[model samples]
Target: MPTTEITHALLAPGESELIEVAGNRIRIIVANPTLLVCDYSAAPHFPGPPLHVHPGFDETYIVLEGRLEVTVAEERRELAPSAAAYVSGSVPHTFDNPGAERARFLSICSPGGFEDFFRAMATGDREAIVGVSERFGYEAVKTRG
Candidate 1:
């Protein structure tokens, strides 16, 4: 078996690549073939993307500040600072800022490349977004209000 090389990166405060998705500002910390890490900040009462599932990787979130309402499958919960949540592959999940202040969190996705979809979305490349979503086996599910 072959071994994968380890990489190192250091980003100062506010130094990461920033992108806007669905009105949320995402700061990309690191994106490699094996992992994608990002910081997400959203305004108060901001609802994130519709329920979605990743067929290829698991996603984890760490709440850094404020509060977030997270929904996974049939369960919903509110996470505060220093809280964490995990959504496995094929599980439908979504999150939103329910607090009165801005919400911030860090997200990590395993087996990387999802950042491509984010970049495409930020650039408003509809075709690329659709293609990347399909290539990465991501599907959105409708949610009832």
Candidate 2:
């Protein structure tokens, strides 16, 4: 399929989604076989709590707006606008907005398919996330969503 720009309104709106990660509102700005770019909004009212990881794909997060508290492995750091972070495959990572304002960022995942994982989570298809994770060589285990 050709690249598509999917907005947040086009996605299933809620407090939590699988396709977008736990603590953010994700809008797929671009999607194709090679790459997927998502726009994430971490609002102050949103409690960013989900800790998850990717197995096969590496991802880069570029802060477009506010600040965020990012935790990768056991280390935690704060990222400001224009700053970026990278998460390699098999690394456990999570983040939340510590600032009072909304945090916006562009997250690009290489090799694309992780988009489906997020989509499944947003649509309430747990099996799809699990299946996709298994095939991709990583899985997200947590006590809550």
Candidate 3:
């Protein structure tokens, strides 16, 4: 079992960097070979980016506080506190927070590496995500996974 607090040997602090994307503060907590956990905080009306799909790792979103607008393929749902959703790998999905309060959520990715993509976004580069799909064992394909 893991220790009570993630110590120095487990993972370094700088290893988990915070990336700011579109007025949202995204912090990568855990990034490993098979699991990835990221914490995201978005101000009210923070519009998410375009819909994208990953062909390798599936994703799960756990809303810690506030509300979120999530779109899995063609279906859209409003998620609140303690609410969660799953999107299989290679599915087109996106999310946004339109409420007045700060929306906080945890994103989990199986087979890891989502943080690389977010880090690229933090650089404020528009085209960084283009090569992300290929770099992180995921293809930016249009197929539903």
Top model by TM-score, which number?
1
Total backbone clashes of candidate 3, pairs 3 or more residues apart or in separate chains: 0
lDDT of 1 at 42: 82
TM-score of each: 0.90, 0.72, 0.78
Per-residue error at 13 for model 1, in Å? 2.4
Whole-model lDDT for model 1 versus the true structure? Answer: 0.88
Per-candidate local distance difference test: 0.88, 0.75, 0.80
Q: After superposition, how far is residue 56 of candidate 3 from its true place, in Å?
A: 1.8
lDDT, candidate 2, at 48: 62
Query: Candidates sorted by lDDT, descending order?
Result: 1, 3, 2
Please provide, for model 1 over 49-73, each residue's C-alpha lDDT reduced to its tens digit, 9 standing for 90 to 100.
7898978889999999999999999
Pairs in clash, predicted candidate 3: none
| Candidate 3 Cα RMSD (Å) | 5.7
Query: Which 10 residues in a row give candidate 1 its minimum summed lDDT?
Result: 2-11
Candidate 3, which ten residues in sequence have the lowest lDDT sum?
136-145
Q: Which candidate model has the greater lDDT, 1 or 2?
A: 1
